[model samples]
Target: MELLGLDSFNLVVRHGGFGAASRACGQPKATLSRRVRDLEESLGVRLIERGGRSLRLTDEGAVLHAQTASPVEAINDALNDIRAGLGRPSGRLRISAPILFANTALGVLAAKFIEAYPDVILEISTEDRFVDLAADDLDVVIRANPRPDDTLVGRCFMRNELVLVAPPGLSRPARVEGSAERLTFPAVMRMGTGDDDVWTIIDADDGLPRRYHPKAVLRLSSPLTIRNAVLAGAGAALVPRTVVAEDLASGQLISWGTASGPEIEVWVLHASRRLVSPKVTAFVNFVCDHFNAPTR
Candidate 1:
């Protein structure tokens, strides 16, 4: 339990500054700073150094961090093992997911998981930004681009692919004679979500990079708006395969490419905790299995 405070300290150190750490932790900047200071007071050592906006671990703090990290993680793992032996998991499991994945994959998987573990109450949060598992108490997070931190364990569960899609009847813009290889079309950019619509494609014929940078006609944060714009034939768009799977299957959307598509990876990450807990472990296992299923 004492390691929990140490874990929080670890986050601030890793993120480099309190503002960034607070954003990751989903806590007010002042509150996170206070908590860190309180933890340092209890430890009787100054663990972090403040240089205006910059942060660095003290010499003693770095040594203590390195020493305690692995053992704290192992202790948590051991506790989780003890809980799982009791059988059915019963507790609250909080999960965060990307907007596209949440709209597409989570629906069926979540339903089945909840049904199998009735005692587990699921709290799901759909956000485009990276979720803070430690402060938010999120059991797991489904992130598009997985970034592992010192205080978190990440597991890649499923594979995804990015495909350029447009409305079924939408006509490809007429390519200029010399610019046929490179075309410019109006596109809806993903704004404020830490992503852009730059399409990345690889040619299987040759291991060459064929990048497509569509001219963004509009920038938006809503995936639904992007989909609607694509459907309306406003312009071409690159969306995740999972999000537009049914559309692709039903011919409502067409995948535009001469070669293969971009590689997409799905990862589930969890913060280092005192224990994984039965509910979190069960839920993680369920998501891993369900997404990797042959039919899914």
Candidate 2:
């Protein structure tokens, strides 16, 4: 069987259809269809079952794809490595990130990375949902730990401290005499999938952890939304320090100290640590190094 035909078939499966594969590979749709058909004929078995507006792989096609996909990817990756070793990083790099990060430092870092490696085409997706790297054909993802999949490798590049904050004009009750007298205020919180309504706080003086079930005035999913609500004097919110640092500096928000919350550890995640492509490696290293460097 011709390797070219097999490669064409693989592209069709990867991109979901001949039209998509044609666009991705910069080939004509009819040409790609003919190549895949040639591959099926040479194997003496039907590979793909074409139906109304959808494509399905026959059993033979499934087996062939399962066998050939990895080898084809490895070969492409090897070529990319050679190109990269010759001095420039090139090729498409697909990344996934949360909306908050994508709107913040990630936007700046991505711009700098693209500027540094002009040949690399960067595609970024922003959402709150967890992405399956292999299934989604993603090269890298930036997210908070604990990672969803154990098979994936993650590099922790930054820590996001969670802090309780309120608007500068919001009134705070006078500090009472006892430990139990620590004030509880209405809070805007991110509603978890579970039914728990508890918030944790660390005692500023004794350094012990405390749990407070504050009355939730509003529950929302987005950190940026929660931050805005707090800034509007709706209620206090436990949020990542990065989200509110500018507000705190500008005196729009006041910090109520560290919250008893999970460490918002940020990680750069990928499917495999071994045999990573040059595009993925360059991006991961650039982000890690940028965050690791000491500030002025």
Best by TM-score: 2
lDDT tens digits, residue span 33-79, model 1 = 77778888887888888776578789988887666654454455456
C-alpha TM-score for every candidate: 0.62, 0.84
Clashes of 2: 0
Please provide, for model 2 over 20-80, each residue's C-alpha lDDT reduced to its tens digit, 9 standing for 90 to 100: 8999989999998898889888889988998748778999998888777655765676687
Pairs that clash in candidate 2: none
Which candidate leads the pack in lDDT? 2
Report the CA-based lDDT of candidate 2 relative to the real structure: 0.79
In order, the Cα lDDT scores of the candidates are 0.69, 0.79
Off by over 4 Å in 2: 1-3, 14-16, 28-31, 41-44, 51-56, 59-71, 81-87, 148-150, 173-175, 179-182, 193-196, 203-211, 293-296
